[model samples]
Target chain A: MPVEDLYPSRNRTEPAILDRQDPIIHSTDFSAAPISEEQLRQYEEKGFLLLPEVFSRAEVSRFLNELNQMQQDQALLDSEVSITEPDSGALRSVFQIHHHNDLFSQVASDPRVADIARFILDDDLYIHQSRLNFKPGFNGREFYWHSDFETWHVEDGMPRMRALSASILLTDNSDFNGSLMVMPGSHRKYVSCAGETPDDYYRHSLQQQTVGTPDNHSLSYLHKQYGLESTAAPAGSVLLFDCNLMHGSNGNITPMPRSNLFFVYNAASNRCVAPFCNQPPRPEFLATRETFDILPQRSASQDRKAG
Target chain B: MPVEDLYPSRNRTEPAILDRQDPIIHSTDFSAAPISEEQLRQYEEKGFLLLPEVFSRAEVSRFLNELNQMQQDQALLDSEVSITEPDSGALRSVFQIHHHNDLFSQVASDPRVADIARFILDDDLYIHQSRLNFKPGFNGREFYWHSDFETWHVEDGMPRMRALSASILLTDNSDFNGSLMVMPGSHRKYVSCAGETPDDYYRHSLQQQTVGTPDNHSLSYLHKQYGLESTAAPAGSVLLFDCNLMHGSNGNITPMPRSNLFFVYNAASNRCVAPFCNQPPRPEFLATRETFDILPQRSASQDRKAG
Candidate 1:
């Protein structure tokens, strides 16, 4: 597949050009870069690699409009959307967007996402879980540092760390907004940071999908070993992180609202293995059991009519 | 097993007894009554039926202790629990309890929950989901009226309304605290009160999980057809309702807190068919795909040491 748009846009015309010290942590695996031995090596070293400008500005604009239309739909405000701030009742995070919104479904299972997943997963794959997270400015929330795989392994019946998540920044993720922060090289060891899965919530709500994080003492120990880095990429950047990589985000305190789509991918062979755990794994929406081959890439942003 | 504990103690010495006009709504399906052709007919007419004292007071006591312990646990509060109010950050609800706490796992799979399922689903079945919803007094949140099946069908790929939920009361549901409210016989016809599933919140937050309610016109029609009734029952009562039954609860302003453990069951014949619809269904914890036959109902409350 053609990785970079040779014509280039006003923002990232020469795709995959990294401004080594641009302060923005962009990935080495973009359209031009693709998945190579070197890029894999870099991901291994850093635990996460950022892909800058996975979509053109036009594509990002279309997505933003569709999102706005859905959010403002009064019908939706009263029923389906939930709030993170109970007092203010402001929107925080959403789930199953791909199922409800056709555009998102395509974006969620886009060839790009599948392509990247195949590089790491190295086998047929399917989406285990998908969600859209928004860090609203000023009233945003903080996701404490922890590993995603910790809960997946213990609760979701995921047997190994073969799965990973792609954080697609639909908006410009500035430092002020709650951008994703990760502890480099933390994935080397499986940190049992998740003290216990509050097995009750699994049946009641989807809050327990992201496993719990480590304690301060253990966190400090890890921090001492591997320094932390915040992802400050522009709009449309795709960040792929190992499932076990320790990561989190700060509450947005600025006027900039940050949002992203996360799609978790797992190899087909690595389905849930509940074994002896009485608690059942997550539902199909969050941790899908079925696996499908990577879909052929259709011109996602080009489908203007669908958009 | 002895249907009733002949030798009465501080708790239920007998499995079930009826004080006819206890003010609390008791099921006709208690010990004196079991699921029969008559009860099924009544359910078809009412859209919901009550089953009282599924657990003994001693069992409820142990469960209550565990819930209290979890809510107060600093480690749990920090890692596993999910809060509704971001600023005050009070405990609103919890998820995955069945996974973390063994007591909850058994309670989630209680035979009582399955017995009701057998009558409704009419086939071999499995747990679709389990959760503990707490309407804490004063700080409790309101659950706007809506149907659970609407969301499951549109979002979770559920093919039929062969599923039902048993809201097992963990605490006495008084008028002051939030209690399960329903519009009788609403399940006979699929209201389609929910218009197009606003796919936006599905990604932005969990609001879309329970598809929002109908507009004023449609709601008025529903109300006119089937008036609302509050499920004010004592602790251990089980309120079983059809999947499409329109239901919700008002926010609790009273000092009494209302909590319930809901276990959803679905017939094995039906499963999710996520065809071309873009939006994905619920996560594994909220909408499980795997099917397991009913577990033999051991005394869910009797597993002492674990509790």
Candidate 2:
């Protein structure tokens, strides 16, 4: 039998609203889960879970220092993995931090973080994508609303909804600043976006997306049905959201800037094939095709206190 | 049968010199070959062939205009694909030009260029890598002596020695300027350089390569055996070199800047697999993993006049 495309999107004339066929949580047992039962319940209900102060100020500061070092290194800043804002030329995103930098790799593998992902994914996990996103004060541009899976599935060939994103705040995410915003319980439905995914969509979409976007009608419907919630948290918080969650953020008009270390964790079994839309798979930095267990041979509780 | 691992280099304790194990030309039939018989003989003998004034001056000027536009766009310049000189931050190289820009893609597929590659490789081809290398007057840095296959085999998983590079000079390459230098007939020997290829070698190697470099002893040996030759040509000239050829360039100290559009063509059958060094594969822009016939139906001579 041909592999069933559980969620089909992109290359369509009209927008679609399909019920998510896959389970939100694949793991049947949560005996060694890092997050609490109540937290899991909230995640299942809302498609997102926020753990406050998961990392200490010192850890966040160290990450910030590393980020500042990378930003200062003109050689690294010049490479294709680093992306700057279109207008101000301020650094916007540095991709593949887990592979590019040593410290970031450690941060990604930290049990405090990896365990949560292991529990949520319910399988051996690997980094599908890792990046450091920066929104400089007053110059940061807005990211329009859309489901990440729409692009990942169409352009990256991600098979199912067995992926999640973890964003570790490096700075305070206030109500005014450009913190991430998500439509509550949006992961239950997959939004099949309109428009054909043109070749090399990530080239421009990294800075500003014009394709593979959720239609205004779908956006309005999701907004009215579930309501939008923006994250307002202190530094060191970790925000985990489902792959199909409808999320986007406004541009920062405030004086303060917002930054986060983002990593997408995918089940090793759900690794990518050829793109669903029949275009070439995106670069590895954008949507990794390699599959290797990130926290090999270590139980979730092994490094709980250490991290 | 298990595939033979020929031309293995990295992960060994020390370097070793190996004889050429593969044929220089894979295509047996030359009925529709684009290059002259003498040109093919010269390439087989020296592992490189230079064609002067292949592109007209007017065509070169348009490409330069496109390059200038890309460099002036702060956003394009800021992206990771646009690498800059380490000391000067002046634009140095842009990776994936064929995918990023339409005009360059047309140039890559042009019969004048693609036909030469087809006649040499003797098989259907695809882009292994595409980049625009710029050496700005005095700010440009030197690229150290190394065999591209050494890195491509160990870091990118290129299975065989069936790849070659075509560099189109966009500016006059005088004797004093930083034009490419090659050791004639050096493609017959493979230099197994010392040291392990560290992860994300391209991150730092793009600015300056510290790893996967040939030892001074090996360099001196090749220099003494084959002697060195540097390209001196006007705009619109084309330089084709084998993948295993020993090549490097001096930093430009002259006031005249040097620039070229470079594209690597590889036989489709020799696509990448797991990296030979046991590290993860480099990003797609540096070394492509895709395998599709580029010029599926058109005969080489068909587009010769059109180009």
Q: Against the true structure, what is each candidate's TM-score?
A: 0.43, 0.49
Model 1 docking grade: incorrect
For all candidates, the clash counts are 50, 4
What's the i-RMS for candidate 2 in angstroms? 22.8
lDDT of 2 by residue, A153-272 (tens): 888888899999999999998644557778889899888887787778889899889788777677767767887676778999999899999887655533357999999888888888
lDDT of 1: 0.61
Candidate 1 chain A, poorest ten consecutive residues by summed lDDT:
A16-25
lDDT of 1 by residue, B222-296 (tens): 666776666788997788888778776655433357888777777777555661134665566556665334545
- Go through the candidates in order and give each one's DockQ: 0.01, 0.01
How accurately is candidate 2 docked according to DockQ?
0.01
Model 1 root mean square deviation, Cα atoms: 23.1
The residue pairs that clash in candidate 2, if any, are A79-B80, A80-B80, A80-B81, B27-B122
Candidate that would win on lDDT: 2
Per-residue lDDT over B1-307 for candidate 2, one digit per residue giving the tens place of the 0 to 100 score: 4356787776688888889888998777756667777788888888998888888878999999999999888988988788887877888899988887999988887778887887788778888889998887533566767888888888888889999999999999864455777888889999987778776778889988878888766776787788767677899999988999988765543345799999999888887778887678888778776533364434555436312
Which regions of candidate 1 fall more than 4 Å away from where they truly are? A1-33, A73-86, A203-211, A290-307, B1-307
